[model samples]
Target: MAVITTKGVEKVYNPDKIPVKALKGVDLEIEAGEFTAIVGPSGSGKTTLLNIIGGLDRPTAGYVEVGGEDISQMSDNALIDFRKEHIGFVFQAYNLIPVLTARENVEFVMLLQNRSKAERHARADELLKAVGLEDKVHKRPAELSGGQQQRVAVARALAPKPTFILADEPTANLDSESTANLLDIMARLNQEEGVTFVFSTHDQRVIDRARRVVTLVDGKVDEDLRR
Candidate 1:
């Protein structure tokens, strides 16, 4: 089944004063359990498209469907709830709460969802182990290396068990080895757990690993290729 579908999607920044068209009638579909990458040069609307797809931003025109539900017209409050319930995000900067330990960071989302403390602890442990960070559970973001922190972030994003993960330049801050390790962990999750991943990145390393690639140029899809 298609987990995400975007049709005639368009986004315009400052429409009244100085309009900047970020996306222009873009169409795309991401199926369940697919590892897809959205690639483009800077100013090509990659981030804008990712934000829209994650329901962080709204489009000027067209529809965005996640699991067959239209999220295009949701109110700000409703959109927030929808995103918490269905989507996961991992950004370039690990974005972990510095005060929280690795395990606590991973458990944070489940805490927000009102999951029992026991359930949160179990899932956090499982996910951290999945990312190969079981030994660093008590470390804070400040104590961890860039790669370790990002791994923690990955575990945190998966805590809610969202329908899919939206990762934006997730390996941008890592060194070659760290990047490879992180990618391997994510790929394993995608394969073994049937987790869908949609990434927006300019990194060739990421594009090379993706099972499908969608290239955006000048706010439009220039090429869509499957490997």
Candidate 2:
């Protein structure tokens, strides 16, 4: 199934004035359970494209569908609800709250979804242990290593059991060992949990791991290669 798709999609920041079209007539489809990479140079609309697909931004034209729903047709409130229900995000920087423990950080996402306290704690604990952070669950992000922090972020993103995950340069700040560990974790999730990963990245390691690579150039697709 096509979990995410766009056709003739466009995002124009200034339509009347000097228009800045971040995504220009982008047409693409990403299947469920696939590990895919959206690659391009800076400002080529890779992140914009991900935002549109994830319903973080509206398209000026064309269709944007996620899990077969026309997300562009949804109201702002509905889009927020939809995202919380189905989408997960992992950014390059580990956006963990320093005041919170690793378990709290993971539990936060579930709490946002109005999950019960018991359920939240259980899910967070399971995820933290899965990421090899069981012993450090009581520690804050500041106390953990960079790799450990990133692992916590990943665990947090998966706590909601989201079908689709949008990761933007997730390995950008990591060392070689950390990047490899993170990539391995992501691969394991895709294989074991059937989580679909679609990431925007300039990193070659990410592209190499992807089952499909979509190349963007000048706000349009230059190529789509499937492994």
What TM-score does each of the candidates earn? 0.98, 0.96
lDDT of 2 by residue, 1-227 (tens): 79888999988988899999888899998999999999999999998898888888889999998878899999999998898889988888888999999999999878989999999999999989888899998999999998899999999889999978999899999998898999999899899999999999998988999999999998899999999
Residue 105, model 1, lDDT? 97
**Candidate 1 deviant stretches above 4 angstroms:** none
Candidate 2: residue 27 Cα off by (Å): 1.1
Error of 1 at 52 (Å): 0.4
Per-residue lDDT tens digits for candidate 1, residues 116-224, read 9999999999999999989999999999999999999999988999999999999999999999999999999999988999999988999999999999999999999
Q: How many clashes in each candidate?
A: 0, 0
Clashing pairs in 2: none
lDDT of 1 at 92: 98
lDDT score, candidate 1, position 17: 100
Model 2 score (lDDT): 0.91
RMSD per prediction, one decimal?
0.7, 1.2
